[model samples]
Target: MVNHALQVSAALADMQIFALEGSRPFGEAVVRHLGLALSAHEERGFEDGEHKARPLTGVRGRDVFVIHSLYGDATHSGNDKLCRLLFFIGALKDAAAGRVTAVVPYLAYARKDRKTQPRDPVTTRYVAALFEAVGSDAVVTMDVHNLAAFQNAFRCPTENLEANKLFVAHFAPALQKEDVVVVSPDAGGIKRAESFRQRLSHAIGKPVGAAFAEKHRSLGVVSGEMLVGEVDGRIALIIDDLISSGGTIARTARACRQRGAKKVIAAATHGLFMADAETVLADAALDGIVVVDTVPPFRLHAGPLKDKLIVLDSTALFAEAMRRMHEGGSVTDLLAGR
Candidate 1:
C-alpha cells in the first residue's frame, strides 16, 4: 500500500487537524494516512447536559480541518453532533484561525434537501447555513444523498468525494469474468449507478448492463414493484448513496432475484443502517453488502447481515483530498484517476 503521508509537503506543516469526541477514531485514521498527528482539543461537559469543545493548541493564522461525521446514534443525536461541530468551528474562527473546513464523512440532513410535499422544510439548506454562520471556509463530505442539492446548498466551497474508485478496485477483479449488471435501487440514483458502472466496466475491461427499480417513498413507507432493465442470469449489483433502514436496497434485491439475477450484492457509500436495517438487510436475496467506514456499523449486531457486510476504508481517499486541497491541487483530477 502507498504511504499517503509521504506525498505531503511542508505546505501542510502548519495545518491544524482536530477530531471531536465522537469522531476521534475516523479522524485518527485520516491523519494516519496523511502521516500527521492529531492536534489537541478539549471537550468539557457541563451540568444540565450542555457541552463545549475548543482547541487546546494555538490555531492563529493556521489552516484547520475538523473531522466530524454527523450521524445520529445511540450515544448522540444528529442534532447534538451538528451543534457541537458548528460551535467548534465558531470557536476556531474566534481564535483567529486563517480558515476552517469541516470534513464531514456522513453529512446529516442531506436527504432532506428538497420538498416533495407542500411547506416542507429544506433542512439541507439550513444545515449549510449553520456551517456558513460559523465562518466555515469550505466543506468536504463523501457520497451525499443528492450531489446537486449538496453543492447548491453550500455557499462555501464544497467537495463531494466519490467512493467509485474504491468500490471499483474492490469489485472489478472479483466480477471480471462474470456477467454483471449495475442496478440503482431508485430512479433518482440512476446517474450515480451509471457513473459507477462506467468506471467499473473500464476497470474490468468489459461492458456492464444498467438497471433501476421503481421506488416511491411516502411518509417512511416504501412502495414500488417495477424493475427495469435485464438482470437474468447476471450478477446484480445495487448502488446507492446510503442504506437507511435497508428497505430500498432489500426490496430491490428481491426484485432482482425475482427477475432471475444470479447473485445480488449492494454497495453504498454510507450505511446508516437505521431502524430495522439489521433485520431488513438480513434478507437471503442480498448475497453481500459493501459500505465504506464513514459511519461505523454501530446499529448492527453480529448476525447474518454482519457476516455479509464488508467495510472499506475511506481514510486514504479523504487524506488525499485533504492533501490536494491544502496544496491547491486538483481534487477533480484525483477523482478522475488522472
Candidate 2:
C-alpha cells in the first residue's frame, strides 16, 4: 500500500472529496492516486428531467472538492452536466462547506469565450458567473480553450492546468529523432503548438520545427486552406486544445499530407469526438491521435479507429494539483511549460 501519511496531512485532514455521477471514474482515479477514498454523495434524477446531488457525509466547516467534467456523453448533454455541477456546488455551500473547489477536468462551453458576431452570448463569461453565483471559492480545469478568457470570465480563483508536461513525457520517445514538426490545426492555436514544440524539443534534445494551418469557420462552414511552414518529409505532430466534429484536425492533417508530410500525429487536450467524428478522424493521412483522459473515450471505444487512439491519464497530474491546493503549496511548477 502507498503511504497515505505522505500524501495527506493534518492540514487537509478536514477535506472531503466528492464526485458527481458522470465523473465518478475520473474522481475515483484521482482519489486512488492520492491514496484516498471518495466521500459519499447521492444523486437522483427526477422523471421530469430534473436532478439533485447531495453530499451524504457532513461537509460543514470542511474543505470540499467535487470532480465533474462538463463533457457530454450519450446519456447526459454538456448543459445537463453543467447544470448538475452548478447545483451541487450551490448545495455544498448551503451546507456550510468551508471551501469548495469544482475540479472540472473537461470544461465545456470554453470555446464560446469571445463574441464574433452581433448579439453573441459570450457563454464562457456567463458560465463563470453561474459558478460564482453558486458560491464556488475556486475553479480548476485542464487546458481551457482560451486561458485569458477563462481567467477573465471568473471572479473566483481559477487554476488552468497545463497538459504540456504530460504530453511531452508521453511523446518524448517517439519524438527523440529529428525532422519532427509540431503543427497547430489553425492560426489561433499557433502559440499552443509553439509551446508544445519548445517543450518537446527540449525533451528530445533537438530543435523541433513549428507549422500552422489557416482555418476560418463561420456558421458551420470552414474555409482557408493554406499551410504555412515546411512539413515535407518530416513527422508532423498536430496539437490543438480539443476536438469537436473533427473538421479542423482532419483539414489540417490533409493539408500537411498534401505538403508531403511523412506522417501526421494528432494530439488534443480533450477529445469530444462529436457528430460523426469517428468517421472524420479515420483519415488515411493520419497515423495516430492522442488525447488526455479528462473526458472518457465514449465515442472512440470499440470503433475502427480504436487501434490508433492513445489516451494519457490525467489522474496523477490532478492529484498532485489537489494535494498542493489542499496544503497551500504553489502550483507554478504545474504551469511551467504553458
Candidate 3:
C-alpha cells in the first residue's frame, strides 16, 4: 500500500485541477479528499454578458481535470456554465494540455437523451458533441439519467459513477432491524431501484422487497394512480436518478403512505429542485429525503422539508476515481467496493 501510494503521488506530479465558478465548493471538497489544492484559474465577465475563464498557471502537457456541475442556479444558467467549461477546455487544449477530462457532478440535459415527442431536440447528444468539439478527452459524471444513452452519446471515454454504494452505506445500519422495501417512482426506474435493492440487501444481510409506482406524463402534466407490490407497515425507500420539480417523488410518497407504508424516504443522486419543487416536496407523506451534493440544494429554504433533507458527500468517490485514473488503477474495482 505504501508503494502504491507513492506511485499515485508521483502520477499526480503533472496533474492540474480547476474548478469553475459555480462548482468551487464541490471542487474544493474533492481536492481535499485527494489531499491536494485546486489549481489557479481566472474568470472575467464582460459588460455585454459574455464571460471568459482560463488557467492562470501553466497546463502544457499536464493531465487537466475541470470540475463543473452543469445545473442552473439564481446567479447563472446551466447554459452559461456549460459554455464557460467548454471554452476553458478549448483554451487548455489550445495551450497544449496532454489530456483534459470534464468532471461534471450533475450533467444538464441528460434527461433529454431521447426524443419522446415529434421533432424533439436530442440535447444530450448535442451536449456530448459540444464537449468533443472542445477537445475533451473524457467526461465523468455521477448517476446520469440513462447510462447507455450517455455512454453512446460521447465518442470519448465517459464514466458514470453509481451512487448505490453510497446509499447502501447510509441506510444499512438503521434498516437492519426494520422491514424495508425499495421502490421506484415510476415503471421506467425499476432497474435502478432493483440495483439499489440488491446492494442494500447485501449490506444488511437480508432480503429487501421491491415495488414501483405507475407514472404517466403527457405534455407537462403528470397523472397516475396505480402502484404495485406491498408496502404496508414497511419502510418504503423511493429511488430515482434525480428529483426535478419533485412531482414524481411527491406522488410516489403519497402512494406509499396510502398503501400503509410506515415511512417513505426518497433517495436520488441529483437534487435539481426546479420551479415549485420546494412546495411540492414538502408533503407530509414524505418522511425523509436524501441526495448527494452533486447539485446543491440552492432552491430549498428553511422549513420542515429542509429539516428532513439529507445531503451526502460524494467527494470521496470522485476523488478516488480521479486517483485511480491518474495512477492507471481500476475504477471498476473501486466501484465494486474492493
Every model: Cα RMSD to truth: 2.2, 2.0, 1.4
Cα displacement (Å) at residue 242, model 3: 0.9
The clash number for model 2 is 0
Q: Quote each prediction's TM-score.
A: 0.97, 0.96, 0.97
lDDT score, residue 304, model 2? 60
Ranking by lDDT: 1, 3, 2
lDDT of 3 by residue, 32-70 (tens): 887789999999999999988889999999999999999
lDDT of 1 by residue, 208-247 (tens): 9999999998887889999999999999999999998899
Q: For each candidate, what is the lDDT?
A: 0.94, 0.90, 0.93
Q: How accurate is candidate 1 locally (lDDT)?
A: 0.94
Query: Per-residue error at 107 for model 1, in Å?
Result: 0.4
Clashes of each: 0, 0, 0
Off by over 4 Å in 1: 1-9
